[model samples]
Target: MTRSVYVTGVARGDGRQVVELGVMELLTRQVDRVGVYRPLVHDTPDRMVELLRSRYRLVQDPATVYGMGYEEAAALQAEQGQEALTARLVEGYLRVARDYETVLILGSDFAGTNLPAELGVNARLANECGASVVAVIGGRDQSAESVVAEVRNAHHAYTNLGCDVIAMVANRVGQGVAAEAAGALRATLDVPVYVLPEEPTLSAPTVSQIVDTLGARVLLGDEAGLARDALDFVIGGAMLPTFLPALTPGCVVVTPGDRADLIVGAMAAHSAGAPPIAGVLLTLDEKPPPHVLALAARLAPGTPVLAVPTLTFPTATELFTLDGKLGAGTPRKAETALGVFETHVDTAELTGRLSVARSERVTPMMFEHALIERARADRRRIVLPEGTEERILRAAEVLLRRGVCDLTLLGEPDAIRKKAGDLGISLDHESVQMIDPQTSPLRERFAERYARLRAHRGVSYELAYDVVADVSYFGTLMVEQGLADGMVSGAVHSTAATIRPAFEIIKTRPGAAIVSSVFFMCLADKVLVYGDCAVNPDPDAEQLADIAVQAAGTAARFGVEPRVAMLSYSTGTSGTGADVDKVRAATGLVRERRPDLMVEGPIQYDAAVSPSVAATKLPDSEVAGRATVLVFPDLNTGNNTYKAVQRSAGAVAVGPVLQGLRKPVNDLSRGALVQDIVNTVAITAIQAQGGDGDRPDAGGDGQERTEGGAA
Candidate 1:
């Protein structure tokens, strides 16, 4: 029988979507083939189902997701009675459950349905389906005591109906009272209860949603601007001076068609990167002249300009009532939702209560999710040297928004601020710390330290002072001086420039021979470690062995079991050459050094990865087909092979993660994306937490790692 989890709410407006989405995230992190079934839905399309299907890449047909429409179900219940209706629902649910390893049953919304006793119906369905219950209670505008009482009542109601209530969630509670509500519930109930405070971003409507709701004509803005959340609305009947002060970040400006001056001023202000608005909503179906509108477009290229037929009062009313929803189009809102859910909820404890066995396959999404969760667990400070770069700044926004780690961005503070503002990114949070490397008070101290560390090779303090002003050196110095835990650089600079400071300042670990690198190749099913990819060109046999040992330790540190495979052009004794000889020698050295490690050498790529090839080539070797760590003979082969796999196989390559360093310092490719930078920063923070140890048993069969490249 397939394990099932039924997510239901006590009443309307419980914001159970967050709980549902969070549960889906947890499920995807554990297993791959998870299914979703909505017992009853409104006449219109299901936004939550579309979101789950898109985000998790589910392949289930859309027609099979729902058992019946709300009206049909109500009619059937009224005419044929309750048992007949439930039988149909059970049959539809089993159709989905039979095909998936686990299924998530989404309960009906308490809206637009004549079905009586909805909660009872949901409870009965859960019992009939043999599904565990996760009850959600609405806490909006409720006191801590009231919320706790409601949760207790909900738990009992489900338990009395013969439902196995596994967990209780108090969602959309007041900000300060989440802790209070959770504490009260924990004191009273034996089951785990989590409280998620209300988030404005998740509730605010996007510009696109407004357009759809009001039937507005969009004259400007791209898809990205349309996705911006309209947190607040500014009614622009006042003059420019009075109106500019009222304008705020992520606010949409609503004005009549004749106020071209206000429109131009607002667009100019947005272009200047102060108080970036979401878009402009023009009322009475009026738009400015083509020339003025063109000027506004020039001022803010991606800012939206919308025209609606309704007047200002009616438009404002409609806009105020429109709430943002989580769906296929609103990805940023999904991120915000997940961030809010993970921050407040005890996910580990909740997942443990679910009793879902971990799957052996580790997909790319699972690996990335695990990275963020692990980095967020023991938060560490990481410094980005290229703070002024757009990708770095965007990545910083995601990191801060997700509460992944503390960040110290090294650059001129003013320039970084301007760039972030121009890109509509807010860096005003407490977790984001920006520093000017040249003018910082710590520059003198860093220079003095750099001079002392390099005095044997150089002579003057002034030279060290100039050298320390460089951002890479400054960031590395910050990590070395214990100001920051780790550093990730090289988005715009070369790999040599990024890690040279680490080699000079942080140096190698005491037992380590040399600093090496590994790229965590995230394939469709599993993650593999490729060593010496970005460092060490043509390493000798001893260096190769050292790289292998360091890579194995790094692999273990992340979660991959270290089954080392020293790759060559040949497998076993079939071929002989200088390259194969060096690999064979390195294999012997790795065994001699770390006898406990499982290692195979002089193995072809096919034999190392493919079971069929391994059976034909070397059937008896334990590590032949099951190798999780592949140590390339040299940088030439390693770099090319990683890129080939990344391009050819659509793998997400997440590093050039430097190993054997006393402190964690990683480098990115020059063309790294925002997500790549985010992954690298998370990896660096995890490395700073410890060097060589087993991570918590969170992910799948092997350790998952990351490096930033195209997938």
Candidate 2:
């Protein structure tokens, strides 16, 4: 039988979408094939369904996702019979259920439907589909006791209708009452009751949503600016000085068309990064002159500027109805929604109730999600040396928003703020520390320490003081002194410049022979580890063995079961040469040292990854075709092979994550994307947590910590 979960709300404005998104996140983490079905949607192409489809990469056809429109279902229930309405829904649901391991049945939104009893209808549909129920009750404008009573009543309603109520959620409760409500509900009901406090950021409308509601023209801004949340709205009727003070972070400025002064001031304030205004709304169909608009663009290149025909007064009134949505276009809200939901809901307990089986293969989305979750479990502070770069700041916003880790961006405070202002990014210095290495109180201390450490190499105090001013050196010093957990740099600098500080100060771990690098080749279905690709151009047999051990440890740390494959031109003595002999010696060293490890030697690429090729080439080898960690014979083969496979197969090569460092320090490519930086930082943080004390590979434990990038 296809196990299914029905997410239903007892009242309007219950904020059930967060619960749905949370459930979907949990389901995808647990099962490989999960489908979404709506018993009665308002339209053929529903926004929520599309959001789920895009976010989860669902393959279910749109026609099969919904049974009928709400109006049609209402008509059938009113004219024919309730059973007739449910029969059609059941038929569509069963068809979807047949193909998926689990189905998330989206219950009707009680707002637009004219059904006689919405909750009763939901209960009947859940019962008919043989699905478990997760009832959502509104807690807005209610007392804690009242919210608790409402949830208990909702649970009873579903249970009385023969629907198995797995959980009762009290959503959108006031700030102080969520705990009390959950406590009260637990005393009254036997079912699990989760309380989610009201999150304004999740409900705040985006600039794009406001533009759509007002039929406004987008004068300036890219998709990123349009997606920014409008947390507050400021009406610009006063002078420039007065209006500038009214601007808040993520606020939309509303003013008449002739108020070019207000427009310029708002744009200037955003450019200065004082408070990032969401956008400017020019009312009364009024627009500034061409020169003013061009100046605004220069001030804040991608800040959204909108023009609407509606005047300020009525437009402000209409803004109250526009709220943020969890959709494809607004992915940040989805992240916020999931974060809020995961923070509040007891997912482990809920998972047990749902009986969702663990998946066999970890998908790419699942891998990324797991990385974030695991990093958040034991949060660590990570330092980024190239903090003033645009990609770095953008990636910082994403990392902080997702609650991945505590970030300390090392740069000149004013310069970083100015760059962020030019890019229209509001980075809260309080939340993310911004330090100038030259002016820091620890500057002299770091210089003295560096001078002492390098005294044997005849380093002078003057040189140490100047070198400590470099952000890379300063960041690595922070990690060495335990001021920060780890460091990620090299977005603009060379790889040598980034890790040179680490090598000089932190040094290699006790048993590690040398520093090597690995790139996580993220294919569509799975992630594989390719080692020694970025470092050690021509490692000898001893160095290669150490590289294999470190690469296998890196793979295990990131949740890839390490089946090490030593690659060369020859396979199992089919040919003999210097390179082949070196690989064979490295394989022997690994087996003699770590007998518990599954390893194979001198295998060709095809035979290492393809089962058919492995059967013909090395049939009895345990790590032949199922190798998760591939140790290249040298850097040239590793680098070229990884690039070829990446380009040809459309794989996401995540690293060149440096392994065998004493402390966790990784470098990014100069052209790394925002997401790539975020992943590297997360990997660095996790590596900090899995320190060099035990050295999981050398310990021979074979334990996997998480699902993430190389090293």
Candidate 3:
């Protein structure tokens, strides 16, 4: 059966698109195939449906997504008495239901329709489609008591009309009243009530949106600046000194275009970071003189400066009516909307209520999406040592844009800024934290601490000071001191230079015998775990067993279910050699210690992942031919095999993600790309969230210290 969710609004301007986007994200995370159906769409090809299709990669046809346009539906309902309209909607929805596992039905907006009782029409359509309803109530201008009453009434209205009202959402309420309204509704309502506080960014008009709405001309600004959110509007009628102080971060300045002094002052303030304004809106259709405008460009090269025809008073009135929308161009708004929705709404509970089945197979896309979503859930701070590298700065932009994690870039601040500027990358945003490793106040303290930790290894204070000046060592110290949750390096440095600091300062977690690595080989269909391929050169029975155990744990930490295959040339008792003996011993040790693990050994590569091969060789084995985790016997074999598979099969090998550290400090390849850095940073953040990787205890700590787990 195709489970459907009807996202409808009780009134106009409810900002239900945010909820719709959020629900779509949750649906994609769980189920593989999701379809969208809109009962009544705008005449000119629904923009919302297009956004959903492109973002979620939906396969549903656009023609099939909508039943009919609003005017057509209204005329049909009026002429045929609503029965014909209901039948038309049901037929369209059934076609979508037949093709997808889950269908997200977008109800009509309650504005711009001649139909009577819009709420009742939505309720009737939901009931006829056999769909559960998530009603959105706009609280933009309502009081706490009124918002609660409206939500309660909407729920009853839907339920009374024989629709399954799964949840009630109070969206866009005032900041002070949002929580109180939510509490009041939850106390009175039986269903899950989610209250979203008003996000100024989501409501703020973007420069592009304003330009489109007001028919304004852009005199000097870049595309990135046009996408900035206009959070507040300050009418510029005062002198430059008086008005400069009124400008706030993300606020748009409304002034006459002839006021050159105010425009220059506003641009200067943005450069100084004294509350960076979104843009300056020139009124009365006047533009700055040529020389003044030329000087304005030098002060803030990319800051949006627009000129609108309306005067200041009328412009302010029109600005009040402007609101943000989620479209293809506004990706940052989408991120902010998702962040806000995820923070305020109980998505797990909502998913459960919808009864969408969880997918059994974890696709590579799903794995990457899960990594990003998990990192965003509890945002951790990750520091990049190679801040001056263009790849690092570019990846930081992508990470910050996606709201993946908080980033701190370590290098000379001037050099980093200049490099980023030359690359056309914007690093002046507040999300990035830039620091000079040598000039930081923590340098002396970190040097003293390093000297103490390495005193027994024959290190003096002077030598420690020199090492502390290094970027890699300084980043590691930040992680150790809890200034950042994790660190990623080696885009331009050797792997040894990256891992040496972690090994010396961070050391191995208590109880861990050694550190190991894994590569998430993302195949076309699924993701497989390959372990100890990068770090370990050779291992005896004990270290090999530890590696397998760690590999299994690592696999499980990711979504992979660990069914480990200890690889060798032999299949069971088919061959005998020194290497085969070691594999057999490690298998026995793993079985004896962790009885719960599904592990197999003395297995050939062909028999481990191919079911047909397993049926011929070892049909009764659980781990054979369907293994998710592959453990290699030696470093030479493991490294070569993984590389061969990666190059030959065109797999995206995500790691060499180091494991079994007290804190998460991952080393990147010297040839790492921008996306590689992003992926490694996400993995490091997830590792940090796993809470202090397993440690080794002194004098025989019984805890297992496995490095990477393969499923």
lDDT on C-alpha atoms for all candidate structures: 0.87, 0.85, 0.84
Where is model 1 more than 4 Å wrong at Cα?
Answer: 43-45, 457-459, 692-711
lDDT winner between candidates 2 and 3: 2
lDDT (Cα, tens digit) per residue for candidate 1, span 1-711: 688899998788888999999999998889878999999998545999999999898989888899999999999999999999999999999999889878999998897677899999999999999899999998989998999989999999999989999899999899888888887888898888888898988889988999898889999988767877898999999989898999988899999988999999999888776677888999988879999999998898878999998899988988898877888888777878888888988899889877788889988888988899899999999999999998898898788878899999988787786566555567878898999988999989999999987887874789999999999999988887778888999899988888778778777766677778999999999999999899788888998999999999888888889899999999989889899999999999999999999999889998998889999999999998899999999888999999999999999999999887777889999989988999999998889787532122211122112222221
Model 3 TM-score? 0.84
lDDT of 3 by residue, 24-115 (tens): 88888888778999988876467788778776757677788988888998899889978888999899999999999889999989788777
Ranking by lDDT: 1, 2, 3
TM-score of each: 0.93, 0.94, 0.84
Instruction: Write out the backbone clash pairs for model 1.
Output: 559-703, 560-703, 653-707, 654-706, 654-707, 654-708, 655-707, 655-708
TM-score-better candidate, 1 vs 3:
1
lDDT of 1: 0.87
The superposed Cα distance between candidate 3 and the true structure at residue 627, in angstroms, equals 1.0
* Ranking of candidates on TM-score, top first: 2, 1, 3
What is the Cα-based lDDT of residue 175 in candidate 1? 89
Clash count list over all predictions: 8, 0, 19
Candidate 2: regions farther than 4 A off:
414-426, 429-431, 693-711
